[model samples]
Target: MQTMRPNPSRSDHKAIALMYLAFFVLGLVGSMTGPLVPALRHIFALDFRQAMAAQWLVLVVIGALAWPAARLMQSWGVFRLLCLALGLMAAGCLAVSFAAGSGYFASVLLALAVIATGTTLLQVAGNPLTTALGAPEKSHARLALAQGFNSLGVLGGVHLGSSLMLGQDAAQGVQLTYGILAVLTLAGLAMFLCGGKAFPTSALANETAAPSEALTSRWAWAGAAAIALYVGAEGAIGSIMINFLHQPHVLNLPMAEAGRASAKIYWGGALAGRFAGSWLLTRYRAPRLLGLMAALACALCLTVAVTQGPMAGYAALAIGLCNAIMFPTIFSLTLARSKAPASAVSGLLCTAIAGGALISILVGEMADHTGLAQAFLVPLVAYGLIALFAALKPAIWPQG
Candidate 1:
């Protein structure tokens, strides 16, 4: 394997700033699914599970494309790959904007799949690159800080999607919102092109480990499982928030109003917690903090399951706070403890995000069959398992 040394003249801070910007755009575009669910269902006349297929398809594309994206990053270089991903995302957004007026459900799904493909490439490159830009020991904290920006994007995306897509003229709203996103994505791509010379290119070099090698490390598998559950639980809850809030027994708000409420309380809580978690991770062990948050999230899901009115609604929203640190912490912890090639491990970890596709379907089914409140049990179990993973002592492995 060849190791590339960093150029002393290159600025790590510039690279980090670019990465944070990329994440922010990712959050903005990626978060539209939850808020769009009601509009999709109404337009397509879909049942709960069918409506959730939009989220499921995006996640499935992520899982399916992750490994290939990792391999592409190795050969193409992170900078070039990021540029390509951003361009692809722009194209996808434009496609979605155009398709919104077509009245064909499949066209929308196809456009989302294109967007998900771009998002997969971004995630496969972005997470590890962010960690590599800083001190190795501070990987968790650095990632958490970056994710805070992502949550900020989610906050804006949620509100924009709710206000635009949930209104009386849903099709026009979808067209305008995604048209704006395409422009923003193109702007991000321009920034990367203009600032390319300042990036620490050497920091993102990958080891030439075969994909199969990552499977040998127990930490890789453990981390993959945790990532899957974390994403699944988060996606399921977010996708259902508007509908759940509209339940007569819960908040009983109108659909459009409920979308706005979910955006502020649910994703907004995540925006707050990630900043706090970033600071806390600097002082506490990543595993301990992860376990604690997972337990708290599990308890909150239980509360939502058994309660009603504002209590249940608020309890559901509060899980976003617990979710704030999980993806970054679990990712960095696994990277720290695994001896596998970083690229291979990252590919496996990203692939595990397919769990969102599976888990969200289960949540949708439960909502259709039993009740939306009872559907909380699925993620409740997922969180319990994640807490168990966090509590286990880290296995000794040589650091890369």
Candidate 2:
């Protein structure tokens, strides 16, 4: 069998579009779980800790699974891995729906873990594949565009979850939504399996490539750390926003209204920021652009932490705009200069995705003890580190 290699064929536009569509669907499936967070809390009568644990369960599983999945892509190729991921997501979605209907909290949590496992694999494979397909200088813009489609998926996920689950009996509405997501998962699986031959094969021929021999060194771990912290900071802020806004002496917005408004503003900011980033990368250096965005994010996190009412929520939402470019920018910067081992290093960087799990838990604990207002400080620390990394532009090459 012929080994797959990255193609610079601009004629493969259809393949590019299909990859973006797959990413869009992946984004939709991932964020669909967000709006369901409140419903899960109500149905299980879970305190903040338990509810947050359920979400983190998925993130931890995804992080744990990413390295193995990267290895699998080396053997099976991206299309097959995508198929496996979609199938897992489908099965997990169906299991969660049934568990919700049966009021089985443990079962629901397990199902979410399953779904996350698949999505993590898809992420590990898909992102690197996209960057590899495009030109060196254009990689950031391509990733930004692909991720913009992801933003649209998030917007739709929130809208779908809100329309279906909000104000309805929590159990039934939530169950139906999961069921719908399951259908979408299956559809995605079928499409990807049929399109199997289009995507490039993994960058590593096998997982055993000597660390020092590889062109793209694990030194990119610096960039990966930034990504993990970035994800954690983003998740922490969004996860706590509703609870923060509802506190008696905090923002004090009504629960139902605040939840919906918060979702809109947060995703709205994400959407706007990604579009702007796509345009900016065409002109500016990614490292400089990332530093500016991190600074803006720090300022916004502080604004949300200290202010109250609509102002606080809006400030929090604006952080999404600052966040929009950081991930793709960091990813492009890290991988752009890399050579043969880009895929393996991509998988390594992808593990930082677990940040969503860890950061949120830390913030949740802080909220439990110090109050949501103070917990916001957790991400502030992360953003500061991210800023320093942005300034350094550390090399991904191996040193003796």
State TM-scores per candidate: 0.96, 0.90
lDDT of each: 0.88, 0.73
Best by lDDT: 1
Pairs with backbone N, CA or C atoms under 3 Å apart (clashes), candidate 2: none
Q: Give the lDDT of residue 262 in candidate 2.
A: 58
Candidate that scores best on TM-score: 1
- Checking candidate 1 for backbone clashes, the offending pairs are none
Off by over 4 Å in 2: 1-7, 200-218, 247-256, 337-340, 394-400
> Which lDDT tens digits does candidate 1 get at residues 340-381?
877788888999998778889999999999999999999999
Query: At residue 4, what lDDT does model 1 achieve?
Result: 27
Count clashes in each candidate, considering only residues at least 3 apart in sequence or on different chains. Answer: 0, 0
For each of the candidates, the C-alpha root-mean-square deviation to the true structure, in angstroms, is 2.1, 3.3
TM-score of 2: 0.90
Which digits, one per residue and each the tens of the lDDT, describe model 2 over residues 80-118? 777788888888888878888887788888888888888
